[model samples]
Target: MNPWVRLMSKNVANICIMLILPLVFIIIWFYLAKSIDNTVILPSPAMVLQLLSHPSENLISMGSLTNNIFISLLRVLAGYILAVMLAIPLGILMGYYAKIFQLFNTFVGLFRPIPPLAWVPLVLAWFGISSFATLTGVERGILFIYLNNIKLSMVFIIFIGAFYPVLTSAIYGVKNVKKTLIDSARVLGASESDIFFKILIPAAKPSIVNGMRIGLGVAWMCLVSAEMLPGSLSGIGYLITHAYTIARTDVVIAGMISIGVVGALMDTLFRIFEEKKFKWQRLIR
Candidate 1:
């Protein structure tokens, strides 16, 4: 067989396998919806699909599904970025230095077990409803509205959710780098900065990226719970909550599906990056 044809056939088989579960899931959902005959309890797949098909259309006066999802994305990114910026550096330092690790490991371990939502009461007490808009002193206009949508309490929750995974991964990656490699670099007259930047980081890039991918997923999950808290007016979580209150199961399902789709897309991008950039890491395993 020709190479191109073989590749095309392989791709088709992969796509078919990927879709099998979802098709079966939809069929089962349709059956259940028909049997129960209760839209509130379990909506038909068609109803949810119809809502998803028109994502731009406003639902239950909580904004369009797309708009709500976008808002949630923004909130996730705000917290997730902060986590990466702080976690990566601290993790690298801790992993590289025994004293630094000892100094912070106990403190980190104390907080690691606490769920992000568990901090809601404390975060609310500290930040209250104050948001980016409050910190920036933007009282009016479009900028203020967007900034105001990002509550500090919500971001803190997201950061907490994303931080530990990233920090752990970075530490593990750096610590696990071959001791011989460090000794070799030292023998080669490499400076401390060169060993860190050129040797340690380059070798640990795969693990760091993997951690970031996981952190992003966790951050996205945290968005729904955060948005359900006080002061949240819009976002997929809020949309789902509002829909549930009014007995609009279809809209709630649509919001959930949107979150799944967005999370999957983001995960796919990370997978692609990992495959392309760290192919050697995969081969070694």
Candidate 2:
């Protein structure tokens, strides 16, 4: 048997198994909708599909589906990127310097247990609840209007939510690098910067990637919560909240499915990159 063929067959089988539960769920949903005669409580899969197809019209006054999704994606990316930029260097330092870790460990320990959504009230209070028009100058244009205090607050919330996982993972990754390896590089007359850039970072790539994946998932969760706030006017979370208020269960479901699909897609892409870029890690494992 050819190895490539065998791998392809295995992948196909896994995909089929992955799809079975969703198919069964849809079937049960359809049956319940017909049997219960209550679209409000349990909309058929078809109803949700109809709403998804006409998202521009059905998404509760929130622009088109594309616009809402793009907004959410942008917020998540902005916060996630900021979190990564801050976490990696700081985390590396914490791991490399015992004194630095000792100084920050108390703060990290205090904050780690707090859920991101718990900060929502504080964030809203700090940023103010003014309308975008009232907050910004008209000369700043639509982009500035869209990125008003409310949106900045949401991004900040997401950054806090995403920061811990990446930071902790990076610290763990750097700490776990073998002391022997560092000693060997130093013995070879390698500078501290050379040791870190060449030895520590490369060895820790897998852990860093894992941290990014976890942070991204948390970031999405934070984005949804932020968008559901009273001042928020767009995004999938806002669409879900708005639809629920109007008793549009189908629209709510559609928004949820959209979020799940987008999250899954992003994770899948990251996984592909990890597998390709870290092939050596797999071989070692």
Top-TM-score structure, candidate number: 1
Tens digits of lDDT, candidate 2, 1-285: 899999999999999999999999988888999999898898888888987787667356667777788878887887899999999898888988999999999999999899888888887888655433454554476766566533667787889989999999999999999999999999999999999899999998888889999999999988878787766888888878888999989888988899998999999999999999999987976
Model 1 C-alpha lDDT per residue in residues 223-245, reported as the tens digit of each score: 88999889999999999888899
Give the Cα lDDT of each candidate: 0.94, 0.85
Clashes of each: 0, 0
What lDDT score is found at residue 90 in candidate 1?
95
* Model 2 residue 240 distance off true place after TM-score fit, in angstroms: 0.3
Off by over 4 Å in 1: none
Task: State how far residue 12 of model 1 sits from its true place (Å).
Answer: 1.0
